[model samples]
Target: MKNKALYTLLIILVQSLHTTALNAQRSTPTEQINPYRIVERCTLHGISLLNNLDTYLSGYNYTGAGYYFNHENLRNAHTGNYNWKYLTTFSATLGYTKQQSNSQFTLLASRYWSGYHPFRVSNRLQLWTGAQIQLAGGALYVPANGNNMVSVKMRTALAATGIAIYRLPVRQHTIDLRYRIDIPLAGIMFSPEFGQSYYEIFGLGNTHGVIKFAHPLNSPSWQHTLSADIPIGNNTLRIAYTANLYQSKVNSLRTHIYNHSFAIGFAKTIYKIKRKDSMKAYSPLL
Candidate 1:
């Protein structure tokens, strides 16, 4: 009887321990199972049609061909919301234009960072609204002018941005159609006064009226992007068209830079795993 009682106690202990282990496994957090972050990177090359007019350089509108390179990164925000994402973009452009014997060149570089929150409109459509901060600087070179050959451009702005995405299924593949637009709300810009030479502003230390407040009335700008992402094999190809219209009137000088570009790019998704979580884990379905 004593031997039977001991055996029964052992069996009960073993069963209790097994039950506890199973319960712990079932209660494990979802994040521990999916310990990786996903990031999408894209690089694009494009040709641009540029229309530039800078009264500081000349009274004529300079029109010509240009080229641009764009790189972007997108990732889910760390706020634990799957519908929120962060986007960063960097772009550079070089343009060349000519008028009667005068040739002009423009070099521009810009960076944008945005945080977007998405609202599902339907099973296949989503609308994202966001705010963007933009930093842009450039210089226009006119070799014909002796003293005032370079017109500098620098600005920073807070913008309201929105994006619409639609998913279309064709046969066995899906295509994502996206449209994005950005409008600057308020900002500050650097501009020299009309007929003011760089020498007076920099060399002579006459710094008055160089920095100006920008608003829609003084500096109206818009950026529009239309793109389609098509899945091919294991990769995604993006074809895009972008229109950028920038204009500012400050210090009695009027300036505008317009560009229309067509771009082709590829996007790749990367999974980032921490060293501690090097082992494979079960990923949740989307």
Candidate 2:
């Protein structure tokens, strides 16, 4: 009996020692699953030198000092008849950004201030407040049909506008799209080009209904937008010749406008950011 008890205690001691050794070995390895730590390791701070900073913001952010080549016209009652012309004006958006992302779309709230159009027209001096919505996110483009590269974007605002930017894969890098939206109007400013608002041009007669539903008035801009771009890239620099042409209707009258900017820009990957969801890799083991 004494011998048997000694053997049992010895076995217990050996087992405890083995477990302690195994635990110490595992402890030395510092196996961890910390997402914050991984994020810290990947954070890259600085401007992306290779990227064309000017084009980086794309349409979302207006240039600090913007120069627009624009065209506008009024047909009879601004719609029943169609008159379209353009202008070339120079101005700057108070708020500016030039950001480009590979996966997610960029959202920007900016003020468009310029009174220049390229097309020779009756009115040469024009000024107003406007906002721009652009697709600043990068995505995969699939060849859909003749002279077009197609990409899908889902927008939920005012009237959930669906935007499909079609790139006319011509040797020129023109990006075009036919799009539409139904959002209500918000934050409008038609102060004046130099202290005289549109109210002065048309008096104030049926301006009530007309004010809320026409160009210079009906900024309730919800229409399918079509844009185009041309390429001006070479070995040293990347240049994109870009143009945007859109036609949308309000209150049964079709309104159309065209804008094109010659942009020279490029971009390179900044740094890869590991998401928080990767922590789940260790979940099942728990």
Candidate 3:
């Protein structure tokens, strides 16, 4: 009789504890929900027409087709009481010249900090002036010439850029017009001496004073971009015309590249979402 009574007591105790646990769980919440905010990024890709002039070989000029890609991140901040904006751009180009039957590739990256100021001229016209620093590097190749088959170009410059923007409100849509120009003021470039053998520079590594500090007289470059952005739903179609003029004179050899291209691309804004309160716990029950 005593054993039976103890067994019965243990069973009742376990049942009571399990019911209490169930009640506690029901009273508490199951899961928590957190809100997230998004940050946007933009990218552009297009095609280009390349024009290259090499003075090394009897003033050879060639025209060809190429491609262009650009990436940008824009942020708005406050500097003291003034509004400030920052834009960083990375662009690349690749082309093939028909006459020389050669290929060239160039890459550029720049950052700008501007003060946002908008004034009215008929409609609202936005003007932005900013200081930019850009680094550029590229290579040009030519065949059938054993002495100098390749020309290596490398440069870094501090530049100033101006941007003019106007947006037109179409019927249930919008068109944006933008024009931007970048002019490099001063920088440095690496160029071999006229008739200098690459074997002496690369193989023997006689690289003293090969890098010259470039001013307006030695190196001058300008880049222009005019683009129109047409919005359709959540995507934007971009049509742009770009022109670049780059010239350098070092060691008595004059080299310049004139490149112009028309590009059609798509621009899309992407976002990254971050949870507001990741650590907070929420109730599953309504």
Candidate 4:
């Protein structure tokens, strides 16, 4: 009887230990999962020097100073994705130019959406190649010309874009040096034929040759941006120089718009937290 009781006690003790072990394992926490997305947003303001020439409106080059505004948002393509990112940007400019006694006022705006795949070259350098779709519209108005005082601009293009970022350690912080470029491949644009007036196209309903297909051969355009991000206290200060060259020869008419600008901006990063349902659905086995 004593031996039987001892055996039963041992079995009971073993079962207790097993239950304790399982309880401890269940109580231990799993590795924390990140439930937030990081996003970068920036806004910039600057002064642009504009040079414009449109054979439909004027034969002389018009040049002047303009105000420029730019806004951008950048984020990863998806949760837990480090190889790809997405960016969206909007920019606008307003200015005027004069040649002799003729004055031309211009307004321009463009929006771009892009996706990039990053190639890490080193610990300090990264190269990103991307593609973008751009939508642009603007108008140039000259008061001196009658019946054809306004030249409207509208275009959409698919562009090849690239960015290079280099990190430089300075004291206790790092400064990012970046360069970006964009070249349009092909798209469509709205243009009136040579010697065609808006009255003839809109009022008189002569709409032929108003919409044209564009390619590198007919509309060769590119943009360049060089920028630096400097950390200041709790904020990042961005200083940039941007140059845009746009040219097109279509419908027997020639047009070009060139702008160079120095810009100042602030960049900030924010985290977007997952919702309660998302958090619950992401539970993992411990």
The numbered model that scores best in lDDT is 4
Question: Where does model 4 exceed 4 Å of error?
Answer: 1-36, 79-82, 274-286
Q: Write model 4 residue lDDT over 1-286, tens digit each, in one string.
A: 9999999999999989877866665455343534336789889999999999999998889999899898988887754545587989899899988888789998999999989898999999999999999999999999999988999999999999999999999998999999999898999999999988899999999999899988889999999989899999999999988898889999888999998988899999975655653444343332
Candidate 4 clashes between residue pairs 3 or more apart in a chain or in different chains: none
* lDDT for residue 54 in candidate 1, whole number 0-100: 94
lDDT of 2 by residue, 1-286 (tens): 9999999999999989877866665455334543223210111111111111111112222212223222212111122443322111121111122233322221212112212112222232222222233221111122222222212111112222232334344453443322222232343221112222234435543233332212324333332223232334531122333333322233333322222334333322122224433233222332
Clashes of each: 0, 38, 3, 0
Q: What lDDT, from 0 to 1, does candidate 1 have?
A: 0.87
Of models 2 and 4, which has the larger TM-score? 4
- List ranges where model 2 is wrong by over 4 Å: 1-197, 200-207, 210-237, 251-254, 271-286
* Sort by TM-score, top down from the best: 1, 4, 3, 2
What pairs collide in candidate 3?
Answer: 30-284, 31-282, 32-282
Please report how far candidate 4 places residue 146 from its true position, in Å.
Answer: 0.6
Across 1-286, the per-residue lDDT of candidate 3 in tens digits comes to 9999999999999989877866776455434421111222456677767777656533667677777777666555555776655667777777666674554443333343333333345564788777777787777776655777777778888887888888878997879898988888888888887777678899999887679988778787788989888997778888888787888877787888777767777766543323432222222232
**Candidate 2 accuracy as TM-score:** 0.22
Residue 48, model 1: Cα distance from true site in angstroms: 0.9
Ranking by lDDT: 4, 1, 3, 2
Q: Supply candidate 1's per-residue lDDT for 281.
A: 31
What is every candidate's alpha-carbon RMSD to the true fold?
A: 12.4, 23.0, 11.2, 14.0
How does candidate 2 score on lDDT?
Answer: 0.28
Choose 1 or 3, whichever is better by TM-score: 1
